[model samples]
Target: MPHPRRTVMAVTSASLVALATLAATGSPAHAVDDPPSTPVPITTPDGALFSYVVNADTRQHTAAVKRAVRHAGGVVVQAWPQIGVVVAQSTNGDFRSDVLAGADGARVESVGATRTVPVSEGTPGSGGTTAYAEEKASGAGRTFDGSLVGATVADPREGEQWDMAMIKADQAHAVTDGRKGVVVGVLDSGIDVTHPDLAGQVDLDKSVNCSDAGKVDESLAGKTSLSGTHGTHVAGTIAAARNGIGIVGVAPGVTLASVKVVNDDGFIYPEYAVCGFMWAGLEGMDVTNNSYYVDPFEYYCEDQPDQYAAKEAVRRAVAFSTARGVVHAAAAGNSGTDLDTNTTDDTSPDDSTPVTRTINNGCHDIPTELPGVVTVSAIDQAGLLAPFSNRGLEAIDVAAPGRRILSTVIGGGYGLLSGTSMASPHVAGVLALMKSQHPTWSPAQLVAAVRAQADDHACADVTGAPCVGTDADNSYYGEGVVDALGAVS
Candidate 1:
């Protein structure tokens, strides 16, 4: 199951790096003028191969920082000088300290481990490799896979998608399925291009795998999607073709780019996510749907050094994409906890063992929490908020149908799954539709229009949870359920 992704306030802009650099002319990040005490350095156990995100003060500092990384016994897997972020891996437990202690480390801003476990996929550029064995799941009947109860015969399984009708996507389709040129980057595991509904829609040229140490590994595009169906499910919801073969997507006319960010272990690490967003910006994608949290930590705290550095690197990536005219939407989460009042988190450092730790609202789910990104929660078939959907009074931007959604799965088939993960793509599809209708609109304009046009659904307690806020805007359904009909209008 896709871990429920969630939200919080966005990180400050990259310009902050200009404001805060090493205190002394050449210091080892002992103290900064602002931001919580010097970021607590990350600890890598002896002999444990770990991945890291090293941020430089600015792009000008990137070269010096790279030299520092090599001196610290680390391999540079991917370097983004545009944002001054570098992805590296090393077995040396003293990499962080050593990097800061080096002569070339003066420009190094911060370094943090990207994962808790050893580099499972092995260091990139080496003979070391990982395999993605395709897993097939075909549906013969609706036992548990995809049995349609109210599906109309005209579109095969169209009626099974009550989510479309709830968001008024079915009605919006009459206006336009979406523009063919609008591209949505599905930043998840991988999108199955072989599926009948998606075959003609996915642009293979724009698709690339970001799982290989956050580098663009073209060979994995479209071919490795079967290893996990989550990305396929998300792609189906966004733009499954309207060929009358199976279910139609929220925007069947829009093109899709499988910016595979999830690795073989089903985790979306910071480096991979950085690769996905940077790619989206470089490819000029109109929008991207983020269904999974950047793993190792569901909530990366800005107060901690490692978490702060990694989280900032992701923020820079998202900011870069948004600046280049791409909009992002992400799941609010599945834990059902009130994001505004979150306390303890026990599921973090997920690539390894999870240990409960004290947390606060300051620690947040990235991309979703990053400012300028549209944060969304999930609603059920009844048009009510899904209990599993995390809600935040100020965090969530909009709500969309998510419970037991029937979407494309592996084996060129359909399956039913639910989560805020399923909900985000609906909004992503809507964004694509709005983008199609208003081609010259800026990302801010599209986001504002969607939030302003959502239907007002009155708040109602879900299983005694006592909804906070009114129908116009609330913790459960931010700006109420998204109005697809309003987008294309």
Candidate 2:
């Protein structure tokens, strides 16, 4: 049963407010210095990776960064605070730029221009750059740390009234066949390359991993983690490569790419995730899928200010990408309470007592809360909202099949799982279908379409008797369950 007392804040409004303010101001509202206009670069002759530290404090140091890049015979490609600037072709291979560098600041941020993986088969515009796959682990339908089991539907599922079967039954209406040319990007763990169900169907030719700072690997390869399977499952749902076996994705023909950002522990540090978002933007991916989010109950209200700051930064990154035409989809979050109002009671954990709920406002609660991103929740096989699914009446824009969802696992076999995590991919797959049909839609337009054509039927009534009827987007079911048929139409 769904836990009624838990409140997860689907706070997407704050994101938009930040974006609007940014646009109006025409500059960043965060604390920091301006980046160098003509930063230099530094690189090693062997092409092997090297590490360096810099001063992240002042203006003269900023000039020093440029001088360092020039002195090293390399050009500054990228620079970020807490992250070092990447330069190419330095004479001695030593580079410095204080735009944000410090002596003790050994922050291993990535720098340098992202390289595009070469294309093998399809036309450039047809599929664009693709994401590849990497190692797979065992166990399906679980969390990255192997700490929890995702939600699943019961046989004839408790919520059969609203299930993927229904979507498949109505697939014809949901998707259209056309030379629309959409490129869907899966930004998660990594795919199960050996899954028979999603073999050749995947466009391994265009995969990339943006986790180690900003290195983009075309093979969609990544370091293995319990969180890795999340990417694989999302990818399978979106395109799975149409090989003869396994299940067919929502849009089997569209091209797919993976931008692995979330680590094995399911940690999506804002800076890293933002870097991935930036790279995808530069690559021009049509739609990007984000299945992971921070567990909100990890921090306290005192930290809310800092949390909002990080969220603002991420929001900037998402807006930066979407402005370039990439669409990002994220989970609403797993916390069962409003992020703004739900504060911990400050009870000390007893010996046998588990840490049931703690709040951490610092982490980006969910990328869903970021601006220009589509926030999704989950639904069950019977068309009822999953008990564990986070509610965001007005905050979430769509919902999808998240319960007992069966998809590719690392070790090749398939498994079932639940959670808004599982539900998020269904929406990703649907976006792929949309891109396949109408590849030209902008991020905002895609969002608008999903909202305008959503099946508001299953939405939760956050303020009523038994809470069952029409109401604005509430905490229980955001925009109700996502109806692919309704959305695409």
Candidate 3:
């Protein structure tokens, strides 16, 4: 990590110009403006689906609720008044009987009110006891009441989540026939095995909670609220279960393996990050998506043997795994600055004497700055670069949809979220499509495909934008927004 001054000074003239242009012109494409007020139903590449939010907390009498829903011909998906989460479905696309009938005054907010249906074998309540109790008490074994009953429906990538839409649209060419499969390892927090949106897709058998394995107390199950929503969201984006009711992911047919590294505090111990990479490598995963980096305050770049050792370990692991055909993708930190840190002068931007700030604080620097990683930046639905995203000519590899992005959530729900955390999945999802298109593609070949087909444009002058095509290589925007339709072909 270098001081902010040095980080800013590292910006070359060409890179600056590109940044200026990107900011003015926005990203290469346009954001969807007329997306309906209701959430858009989506299908994951795997066939898993998701719907919108339904207010079921108001439903009091359990029997009355069932009868009402049955009268409307709607099937109650799942209910959790404690968290005010309920999902219902209708195969015929009838909104009233499907989501609003049984539960009186139940304001159906999203598209069809998505419900998660777990297809993973073994225990149905493996995610946590909290989730189990909610489902069990909601009449798990009862039959529908009658015409009021609505069959459960799966909706994938609902809402105005245009970012995921683009990614999914790209995969159609590679996986429409379902002849190929790709596994992506999401190294983040833990995943919710019982999430309905993740129905049929969570690889519970291979899932592990490495944060604090033996910390369960007598009063509670061996679980923590911080079980890994981040990982769950990333997994849903990559390959959510493709059954028919919840939101669909870009590569729903692909397999997702969860490997927890970051904790509730979102701080990933370098050692855990390294171990995650190593394990994913051994598992023969096709791609690995890392949406987090060491927090700036916790970054150690100088006089810290332990910190450097951890970084080196991760770097080595990345190299080893990539050599075996795993495409490693990491977010290029959230800080908006020039990421080049190897400075010739330790002085401030004013050319004053060097200070400690010039030597060791993580300024514009990021873990994505490391070599051999496909470091990505963030872009909005309108194809504009996110203002908070970091940039550098030599450090970044590419850009993707990151702002106001939508994906799966805990306890079978969905919402709008922003961050490079969201953007990285766009690339990972595209990579899955690439692998399916060319099952025999090497890691290098995949990278080449993306670079060659990227949109070469700049968005430098308009607030925060990507810098693309200003140079033969990449500056701030890398090769530019990844083109799923172009890259796969």
Q: Which candidate is the best by TM-score?
A: 1
lDDT tens per residue, model 1, 278-373: 999999999999987777777887556678778888999999999999999888887787777676677766666567776643477777888898
lDDT of 1 at 15: 24
lDDT of 3 by residue, 1-489 (tens): 533323322445543553344233321111122111111122222233222223322324334444444455545553333223333333434443343433443432112222122112112212211110011111111121233212233343344557755544434534341223477878777666566645455454444443331111112122223454566667777665445444566666667766766544444544445556666676688888888764212233322222332343445567667887899777776656556533222221111121333332222233465555788888777776677776666666888887765566666665456777777777887787778778898888888887777777564644544453474455556887776676456
lDDT of 2 by residue, 1-489 (tens): 222112223334544453345434322222122111111122233343332322222322344555554454444434433222332222232332321133322221212211111111112211101111223233332222212111121212113213455455135323452122576777776666556544444455556665453444444335232254667777766664334344445555566666667544344444456567766677777888887652211231212322332344455467767888988777665544443333342221111122444443322244676666788866667666666555544456777777767666666655565667767766766666665556667778777776666566644343321233254354555555565665455
Worst 10 residues of 1 by lDDT: 125-134
Q: Indicate whether candidate 1 or candidate 2 has the larger lDDT.
A: 1
Candidate 2: where are CA atoms >4 Å away? Answer: 1-162, 168-170, 173-180, 213-227, 241-244, 294-310, 345-364, 458-472
lDDT for position 186 in model 3: 80
The candidate, 2 or 3, that scores higher on lDDT is 3
lDDT of 3 at 383: 70
How well does candidate 2 score on lDDT at residue 367? 67
The C-alpha lDDT values of all candidates are: 0.78, 0.48, 0.51
What is the C-alpha local distance difference test score of candidate 3?
0.51
The total of clashing pairs for model 3 equals 69
Listed per candidate, the RMSD to the true structure in angstroms reads 6.4, 12.5, 22.9
All candidates: TM-score: 0.87, 0.63, 0.60
Ranked by TM-score from best down, the candidates are 1, 2, 3
Mark the regions of model 1 whose C-alpha exceeds 4 Å error after superposition: 1-42, 121-154, 220-225
